[model samples]
Target: MENISAAPETQIKETSFLSLNPSTLEVIGEVANTSREEIDDKIEKAQKAQKRWAARPDAERKEIILKVAEALQQNSKHLAAWITREQGKPLSGPGANFEMQACVGWTQVPASLDVPEEIVFEDETRKDILYRNPIGVVAAIAPWNWPLMIAIWQIIPSLRMGNAVVIKPSEYTTFCTQEMIKVINTVLPEDILQVITGRGEVGSYLTSHPEIGKIMFTGSIATGKKVIEASVKNMARLTLECGGNDAGIILPGFDVSKHIDQLFWAAFLNMGQTCACLKRLYVHENDYEKVVKALTDYSSHIPMGDGADEASILGPIQNKMQYDKILDLILDSEKNGADVLFRGQKPDLEGYFIPVTLIGNVDNGHRIVDEEQFGPVLPIIQYKTLEEAITKANNSENGLGASVWSDDLNEAQKVAAQLQAGTVWINQHGAIHPLVPFGGAKQSGYGVEFGIEGLKAVSLPKVISIKK
Candidate 1:
């Protein structure tokens, strides 16, 4: 309910965009501000479009994907500029480029890739066969933090697997996604790949809507559970890539300095607005003080707040609620006997900024360590043996990602395997490749994104039998 609408930008293109800013809560775009009835129309259009899209050959469907890639690169500068203006992230660098990187990730399907027919023969008499076919209409509700990339992560795979997609982006950053879709619609039929704009009500309408064949979402777990409950009417296939308070273990080694640098990037990249950011860190007690000292010294050099200029390392907290929740968690951690080592402080009211905070003596129950802070905050807790460290790492309900750092690759590998997470890192953190599948276990939610598994998430299996 902050009606933060602004006067439309002069000469803005016509689209179903929303009037919201990525950093400062100002309304500065030409947003359609579509109603629920209008969205209902788009859904109907998408349903009709899917019939033709599904009727097309798989290769033709894949061609549209490559066309999307070409359009993205040609419009990369425009996209990056839009991202910076909308999200307030670094415009010319890593932050601005991820949207393009994500677009390129799905440009082409793997050559020589075959989802072969799987044949199951129990006895000589009966045979069961399985192959893959496309699901009908996919309803994708993506988060705003990384609007273009997250949307691409959801949209591209679903589209590539031959399913028509209907995307509902977070209200805060719908402009960027709408811009992304604008480029793709040039080559793709508007009905096949469409984006609808609105708040939670719009998303709720889509989730429970009977026409959708499946729901793939990325956001907080609370909302994720709601989607699951709402999907029961049609038993829609669901994949929830929820939250993560991911942990990292740094072992004593000669190159611990390098590992500390890696941790700094992971802890504060995108202003620590990452799901798999290294939130909880455990260092060997012998070198614990040294690691903290090195991190604090290095961290001080990296500035925070409003990453509009290319030189700034971190940006604003995306929105106000996230800005406050970060401060609240730090306070709760302090109340729970956690020591505040290095706390980032910026009093500029214009920038919704939270400093890069590091906490010490964090336990299993502390909010700083237990839940996903989703900010530029790092907490350090000490542990003795490898088992104790692994025990602490696996104690959380989140199993999204974890890491171990040591000069000894074997030791790091050993610890990495022991951590109960989807992706593990050795000597590095947040190093991701598009070809690798990543997700979480326990309360971290389900389903894998990227790599071969990602392609399969939106694909349905079918069996054709040949009997003689």
Candidate 2:
């Protein structure tokens, strides 16, 4: 059918800040809000291609994907610039090259994670061998935080395993994702990987569609729960990479003076929008004062402005609701008797900028301490014993990721082991590689992604018996 929605833009202007010239917030780009009918039609077209893509030899499928990866690498500069302008991030930073890395991973499909693993079993007179196969079509609904990188995380492995994909991006940040798809479609077959965009209604339609075999979604926990309920009719296989109120524990022996700089960057990168960003911190009471002082002094010095300015350290909150939520959490924190460690007033302008606010002595009762305030806000809670600390850390419904900091490696390892998070760090944050598996526990949702585990997620395993 070769069906895809024609991009509405006739002019390709630099799509950074779409509103005010001196605006604090970054605009990325404006999508010409699409309709549900158009999206459904696009899904039907992708479904047609998906069936044919499934019939291709696995090697033939990989050959076309390798070309897509090459195109991504070639246009990486263009892609990075687009990410900065459209996503309100720095021109160059830790995550600056992440999208490109995703492109490479998606296109190359590294050997370490390849499956098609053999299986064996025996029961008296019976013998069995195993096989792995694709799950028809895979559905990827991406979030805005890591737009293309997260999309690649889902699409690449799914495609590599011989499953076709229909990608639905967040409406708030769909332009760059759409443009990336356009560039990709320019070089590769459009039927294999198709881009569909709209608000919730369109997403709900495709997600609830009868034809989809499996669904992978990365977003809030609330939405994740809803996705699970919606898929029951089809009994679709699913992976939900939901939100988190991740913890960072500073152990008794870690010298606060020695690692304050490292801690600051970990807590504030991408203005703390990351799922694994240090949303909550538990410090031993003996070292609490020293650590808080260092964080306070260091945080006051970082400049804040728009992401495109090149000099700004923290950009505005990615969207509006996040802006209000950050402020509300701060107020609630203070009301619950926690100490405000920095500027609590949100930027008064229309742009969504909330000052980097760090609070301490926040108990579990407070929303700031308990909830996933996914902004550049850090809350500190003091713990008396290692038992209390681990108990408190694991108290939340979320267990997506957590970190422990200590110069005493043994003590840190002890606590990291006790914490009930999916991914734990010794002294760093947001340290992810393509080979490692990542996901969560409890209300943080379930399943894993990346590396061999991620590749396995894109398919179904089976047992094949051969005559002896």
Give Cα-based local distance difference scores for all models: 0.75, 0.74
- In model 2, where do residues sit more than 4 Å from their true spots? 1-34, 95-112, 122-126, 344-350
TM-score of each: 0.90, 0.89
Please write out the lDDT profile of model 2 over residues 40-153, one tens digit for every residue.
566678778777877887777767777788888888878776666556655545544655666676557542345755657877666787666888777788887777888888
Q: Over all chains combined, what TM-score does candidate 1 have?
A: 0.90
lDDT per residue, candidate 1, 31-53, as tens digits?
56455566668778988888887
Question: Which pairs clash (backbone N, Cα, C closer than 3 Å) in model 1?
Answer: 6-27, 131-462
Give the local distance difference test score of model 1.
Answer: 0.75
After TM-score superposition, the amount by which residue 138's alpha carbon in candidate 2 deviates from its true location, in angstroms, is 1.5
* True-structure RMSD for candidate 2: 5.5
Q: RMSD of each candidate?
A: 5.2, 5.5
Q: 289 in model 1: Cα distance from truth in Å?
A: 1.0
lDDT of 1 at 238: 84
